[model samples]
Target: MSENKGNAFDFKLFKRLMSFTRPYRGIFIFVAFAAIVMSGLAVLRPFLLKLAIDDSIVPKDSEGFMTYVILMLVVLILEVVFQFAFIFYTNWLGQSVIRDMRQKLFRLMTSFKMQYFDKSAVGRLTTRAVNDVETISSIFSEGLFMIISDLLKMLVIAGFMLTQSWRLSLIVFIVLPFIMYATRVFQKAMKVAFEDVRNQVANLNSFVQERITGMKIVQIFTREKTEYERFQEINKKHRKAWIRTVWYNSIFFPIAEMAGAIATGLVVWYGGLNVIGGGAVTLGIITAFIQYAEMLFRPLRQIADKFNTLQMGMVAANRVFGILDTRSHIEDNGTINYTNTKGEIEFVDVHFGYLEGEEVIKGISFKANPGDTVAIVGATGAGKSTIINLLNRFYEINSGTIKIDNIDIKEYTLASLTSQIAVVLQDVFLFADTIYNNITLNNPNITEDDVIAAAKEIGVHKFIESLPGGYNYNVKERGSMLSSGQRQLISFLRAYVSKPSILVLDEATSSVDTYSEELIQTATDKITKDRTSIVIAHRLATIKKADKIIVMDAGKIVEEGTHHELLENEKGFYRNLYEVQFADGGNP
Candidate 1:
């Protein structure tokens, strides 16, 4: 996601973000019209004052003076109305555009493959969805529309000045080139600083989220002081990044103010000379010129400020578009429909690597017939889990074919294929929700009675009844409120309720307590009955009754037989693995 190193004003990205406003074009047009009207109305105030002073006040004409004052009042009222419309619609347009963009970004994120998430940070994606999108919003509310209005106001004021006195107009605008040059420099510097600030924000969020999620590990290792110091370092860098932008603001605004003051002083000094020389100039024009000079230069100052907002918004857009442009998605082109089938699976010469040229599953093949229980046993890094991952098509294989019931797995839609295969992993993820919702996953078709019946069949209904709220009890984030064994049982019940054609248990019994183990084994018996089951087990005793056992070593199938048949081979890998577990007094 960090590959977006774009310019301060990227026209390509600007045009892309503007496309989101297409739905609200009517509102955008209204805002632009209001801004133009407001700019024209703003220019009228000074002209009205000039008329009141020169045409009425000087000659003591009371009626004319009142007429001009009343006209000024009317213009002020119209300006207020137009200003209100400008602010309201611009803000409305900004919020509407961001709503569409946020949805698009989030929806696109959900479609990316698991491989994309493997290397991406959760906090970075969060920042892109929330903070970066908010920054883009300011482009309209505080940046784009306001810049247009200010630009129009400056142009109109400049035209009025030229008509009134060309000499004073030239004098007042002499410092403009310098202000513009300074603004450009400030803008370039600020772009880099704002990007740094955003990067640091993501870093800080990533560190905090990971640390909070693993707080137990930190405390168990007694690394509180170390972690605190690490946090302080990240926080300090975040502060410095923001201070850099503040430092740029400190320099730019003061220079803009100084330039405006200089312009006003030049106008006053030169216009005063014309009056002393008895030129065809009234004091009213000089006074009006002063107001006009301020009106013109003041927006220039604000433009510098608003341009900072515009730059940041564009940077954010670039970042968001980068994510949207990612092509790392699993293709779902299969036309096959999902239906009941006799459970069977076959892997033919399958080869896969999580990273390029680092094959985890190399030319492996296996088969599980209908109602067959197949257990895969191996040491860590022996590619036991990779097979299950491949069966689910979580990651595309480098080269191979996996079929179910004599049909290629890729020929069926991912949704259709996955609906028939249920997997229970060692680490179970539960939302901060009720047990019933977690078990049924909020499936409307699965009633409470269905859940109860399934739990009872698996011998876990008694444990559920013992809880304070029964099935309604809340399991907090990641099921932190429950013991490891209890959480495993919930996962088992969740899988059982799905009624899958094929069930996979990936090291589901390795880390649980004795009581949990017994409950899981009972649940396993009920779930795997009359279905094709794949058990990846670290404990040798858990799969002793399997119809077939495939022992993997270094990504190759070294032994394949029933438990008793494999045990008959004295030096076989499976026999060695089982005997070693028994020798260490571990479960076997």
Candidate 2:
């Protein structure tokens, strides 16, 4: 995320934001009408008072005075009603707009290429989707429509003052230029200040989110004290940014209040002179002008404040739209809707890289015939995982043809292709949800009976039933409550239930204890039977029975044959790797 420069307010950006209101135009128009009515109500009160004082009170008509007071009270009650309507509907507008925006943003993120997630920090993305989206909500709840209402009310007040006495109105106008000048200065300063404030807020959010999520790492490394110092520095930046806005506010408001006071004082002094001089300006007009001047200048003061809020919203919108504007998602232009496959897979001259000019999978080629179990053995960073990512179209290849059933994988719709293949990642992720939901992913078609039967087939039914809630048990965030083996069992069961024709297990048995490994091995054997299975394993013993073994080094296939055939070659890459693991007392 780049720091936001305190540039001029973007009306084009603002106009784009206002388009979200189209969905709630009924409420929008209602709020607009309410602002007009409220402004009229505000203007009417002063007019009624002038009439009450000059006509009813001075003429000594008690009945007329009471009638005028009753009318003012009625207007006051109506004003309160309209104000309530305005506030409630405006807030509704804000909430609705944000809800829609949040959904759109999340949907966009869901389609982004895996490479995008690889490069983006989890904390930064969270800040954009959560904090920035929330800030934009203020445009409706506090910024845009509210500012419009205030401006409308201010204009109405000015009009009423002029009708009362043009000369007195001119006197009041003299103070406005100073107020306007101050407001202009305040507006520019606050725009930049708010940009800084919002940026700091995102940084603070990102820092805090990362720190909390990685607390275990901090504790294990004994870096808590160092991290705390770092947090304090970031926290200080956030505080300093906010304090600047508060400082600007303090300076601007007092100046506005003083200016309003001076305007009223001028109207009072000048009006008093006219009344004493027996001129046209009356005491009734003077009293009304005082109220009118405050009404006029109060919104002028708030306009500056509200404009800063608008600036904050614009800054947030700019960040969020940055994400929406990215075209990094995998291209899914394939029109073929293939839901089933014979599972014959081929990779021809495939090349890929996470970064430009740094190919991680270099012109690799391999094939897995239907019902064949092919094992890929490689050291870390040998691009074993990158192969599976490309096969699933999580990232596009730099140059390659990946085919299933002799049709380019890109010739199949992403869903049609992915639905036919299920990947069990090395680092399995489970949502904070029930075991059943995690396994079924809330798919309406995958029933509890289906999960249970599949779990039984995988020899993990008893394992699940032994838990306190059995399949209904809740796995707290990221399946933290479950052991590594247990989570693997759940992941295997999830893939089993999906019934994908092509199954890829990426280091499924690498990180678990012996008992867990045995359970996963049993489940893997059961699921891979008659399915096109691609298994990447660290243990040579796991892939011994695989029909073919492709040994990779530095992203290239250096040895290709069965386990026994590769072992027969004394100097082959697989033979050497196997001997090294055996020498290290590792599974071989």
Candidate 3:
């Protein structure tokens, strides 16, 4: 949530925002045309009143008065019609623009490398995609289009006033400089206030989203009071930021009303003097001038108000655009498209770090041939998961080449490469959707029968069938309704159905119970039957049957052999880890 730190309005940023509306140019153009028409219609009302007063009422002709009154009604009806059209088109244009922007923002975010999300908060990004885009909607719905219509009305009214009585019009113009100056001051103050408000809003959204998502942890640790106090601090800042905007509004509006009142009084006094002088200004003209003065100054006040909406929209645009402009993205320039990968992975002298110059995977080299099962064993942060990340190209390696089927992995399109790899993490995540949808992930090609077949093959179909609605049963958010083992079994079924060439189980069963772990172990045996699989786990029992065992410590591989071969080395890292775990009565 970055603050817009420039003038009240950043024209350059605004122009960039307006570019998103190009796709809906036709609707936007119609909206502008409607504003012009509405403004013209609004100005005509005062002129019609003048005509009725001088030509019908003053002459005391009842028939002419009726005709003029009907004409005034017609004008009012037309204004109402055009005003409706204005509202419709402006809102349509707003919805259309934000719809495109929100989609683009989501697409852009999803395309970013994992490194970007590694540092960014989920709630902050959610705010940008949902809340900030809604603010941009206000730019058209309540701000820009309406401001244009109001300004046009003011200009047209001023033109009419000049024609009717320049003396009184000049009196109205005298207060213009003061009001304009006050508005400028108010706008600058409000802009700062609004930026603060938006920033605090994003912060609050981030805090609440994180707290709610991690509520189990809060309650388990008995931290409800502590978390509540933290939330209060953030809530207070949000309130204070908004109150600042309210304070500015309070100070500015009264000044605008006073200016409008003074302008009206001056028009009355000057027009009365002109009429008393017995030559130019008529009663109808003085009366029209008073109405014209209100029209002229009212928009000035409204423009100040609308400018706030416009400024908030601009700030939102700035924040949304900031993410869109981020270069923290993986360049998907590879043109190679391999539909069926052989799944022969080779990491040659791969050196990489999530942060600069601090290697996570330090000069590591490994190879997994087609249909081979390679298990990676290491202490936490010993670069075991980092190896899997690099293999999948989630993060770019600092130096060295990772090849699949003897071709550089960088040469293949990301989709073509990633489509062949399926990963199941320890913390399995399921959507707030049905069990079938969670397994299929909305893939149109993955039929319910295919999911059931895959589930049966992986040994979870019986468990799923036992649930209410079976495959159609809702898993709720992140599979909250299912046990951890049940969720992991679903993850296995999902991977099994994908028919991936390479399978990765990154501590996939580490968090499940004994019954679930046994079920998952059976699922795992079926899923890894004929794939180039990389299994990274502290649970040595899961990988004892793997073809090759790679042992690592302090970001380097210390042993490479079968489970029995590694165990024969008494001084080996794998042997020490296995001995320590077995002594603790842990399955290994």
Q: Write the per-residue lDDT of candidate 1 for residues 301-326, one digit (tens) a residue.
A: 99989998998887788788888889
State in Å the error of residue 125, model 1: 1.8
What number of backbone clashes does candidate 1 have, counting pairs of residues 3 or more apart or in separate chains? 0
Cα lDDT of model 2 by residue, 14-78, tens digit: 78888888999999999999999999999989889998999999899899999999999999999
Lowest lDDT sum, 10 consecutive residues, model 3, at 1-10
- Assess every candidate by TM-score: 0.95, 0.98, 0.98
Q: How far is candidate 2 from the true structure (C-alpha RMSD, Å)?
A: 1.5
Model 1, runs deviating above 4 Å: 1-6, 584-588
The digit string of per-residue lDDT tens for model 3 on 428-478 reads 999999999998899999998898888888888899999999999999998
- Model 1: colliding residue pairs: none
- Cα deviation at 397, candidate 1, in Å, is 0.3
- State each model's C-alpha RMSD to the native: 2.1, 1.5, 1.4
Clash pairs, candidate 3, are 541-588
